[model samples]
Target: MALLYQFFTALWELTGAMAPYILFGLFFAGILHEWLPENFIRKHLGGDTIFSVLKSTLFGIPLPVCSCGVIPLAASLKKEGASRGSVLSFLISTPITGIDSILATFGMFGWIFTIYRVVTSIVIAFIAGIVSNIVGERGDKDPAGSSASPIRPASFRADPPAPGQAGGACGCDGGCGAEAERGFSFFEAMRYGFVTLMGDIAKPLFWGLLIGAAITVAIPENIGEWLSGYTWLGYLLVIAIAVPMYVCATASLPIAASLVLSGVSLGAAFVFLSAGPATNTVTIGVVRKMLGSRSLIVYLATIVGGSLLFGLGLDLFFDTMQIDPRSVVHMEEHGGWATLLASVILWGLMLRFLLPPLFRRKRRCEGEEDSCCTKG
Candidate 1:
């Protein structure tokens, strides 16, 4: 089908350049998954108040989770007894930035904007989390309502378990078995993380690729032209459009840059940049259950409000300071080799991750336990 081809092409393009970073990010995520404890998340974050929200926001800031990856992880955190505020904070913070995204962002938008993004995201997530808690129920209430939490291995805690012990190895029911002893080594954990991330995201990636390819091939003209004259309205529209979309945080960056280059207002681009990957429906539902309805309201308000205000502030700053944003595109010519290299690296990483399991068993049989495999 034409649609199917478009989808695959899109997938290839989106995943083509940055696949390696994504893989490495997954590996680290698994490591943290093994090392971190759920009880610590619960004890420290189990409160419907400002302090808990701040704690979660701060905790989420440096971790390198993107939109597609954050959902299950946040849900898992909630299932592990993390407070609604903490979950809310994770939801808000996870998408806006991460280690992979930060590097990608720095590459595209220079250090100043990158720094602005990280700082602003943290501040916004914290404010949103705090507001959610204030508007939501007390901790004593039925924290687990209509929504389902993540399936956590029972041994999860804030503190890392003993060196030999697996953190959070208790399957959802807290029963231990022989399977539990097959602790995942770092490489194994990394592989699992990559597979898990792919499994979780493949659907969205398929859809996104289809849409992106259509936009690139069929809609080459400037799509934001209609709102070009009305800067503020255009910015709001960006938020509305982005909230329901499932683009990755970093993938959205180039598109945002392209929009900005096309005479779209910086504010509108900022709206797209911030909202495109952050406020999708999955996160919305997560917010509803984790923060409670009232807190969800606050969370949405914070994102929408914060984005608009920030956009406006940025616009004024650029104008008042006479700061002209450099072009998102570099040379007038394309970087063919750069593109090819990026593609090879990305695809190579993906293939390496997807294929190793077929051969890794031999290493295991040879009595070589991979230290790189995570044990969570």
Candidate 2:
């Protein structure tokens, strides 16, 4: 019973700490969605030069999208004539570091850790982009050998997409033009920021919090001390667990924090953070389908190898500098009433979007025996 209480307390604290920043991040994302030109990304990212890759990485870093959401966006970029390297860089950087994730990292960890994560993510993405360019075929052949034409337009479209048409996959439902068509009103931004973006992240964030609380309760307090003796083993163990998992960058922060609280090395936690959100089985298959097998290989190799090397460097730096992960965790800023308010708003949005629709479907199934929900 006491353990259960502690677990809930920890979960609430973590949620409150992250809620405000997440709301802020989502608002910025909505603003970007509304204001950025329809052809902004496609126009700048289609070239075969290193500059294109750098632009892609930079563009992806602050965008709020996860691995699952990035697939369709990357597909759109590919369809619009983005180089394979630029696409790969966008894929690598976007999911691993975002405005939401960066803010959450700062809320849970500190400025130094947050900066490390962002810089390392960019470096890893750059390496992957460069490697993909070197190994990838430069022609207009799709992965399945279909010929694709470059779709660069001479001018940007001022009007947004009509209703029901899907937008660019930056985790926005209506895309860039959707809001523009509606005059980019405050209410529209609020809906996208609080509702659409919340729906996108709610499930993953829920699971992340649950798992983080579970790890807090399950792992012994001295586990870190025991694992400290086997540093490389810890790194490998974390990588093995993180590589195929689908945890989002923002959601993974609390879990990493809990792991650090349980005595895991910062580097080991860093490994999990680096690989967990960016690379998953579905993402790997999607990359293979989008780029060739060679680009896929380079993508996987860069993330895996770069994460390990960066993880080792972090550990060495911590040891030499006498920095403590626990101290960083303790340094996290505690939220006051605003955080609590944000948490309530976030939960309300999640329930409205994630649960009520299912209940409605179930109710409809109860009324109609031939309903698709009943059939399924």
Maximum-lDDT candidate: 2
Q: Which candidate number has the best TM-score? A: 2
Candidate 2: list runs displaced more than 4 Å: 138-141, 145-183, 330-335, 358-376
Write model 1 residue lDDT over 341-367, tens digit each, in one string. Answer: 665655554444445565233332112
Clashing residue pairs in candidate 2, if any?
A: none
| Per-residue lDDT of model 2, residues 1-376, tens digit only | 9988988988887788777778788888767655666667878999879999999999989876677768767876887788899999999999998877888888778789899999999999998998788778765356862134222211122232345553332113324222243355666555556655666677888889888888878899889889988888998888899888898898898899889888999888999999999999998888887898888888988998999999899889998999887788742445667777988876665566557656334333222122112111
CA RMSD of all predictions: 6.9, 6.3
Global Cα lDDT for candidate 2:
0.76
In candidate 1, which residue ranges exceed 4 Å CA deviation?
1-43, 79-81, 138-150, 153-170, 176-185, 192-194, 198-228, 326-339, 347-376
TM-score of 2: 0.85
TM-score of each: 0.71, 0.85
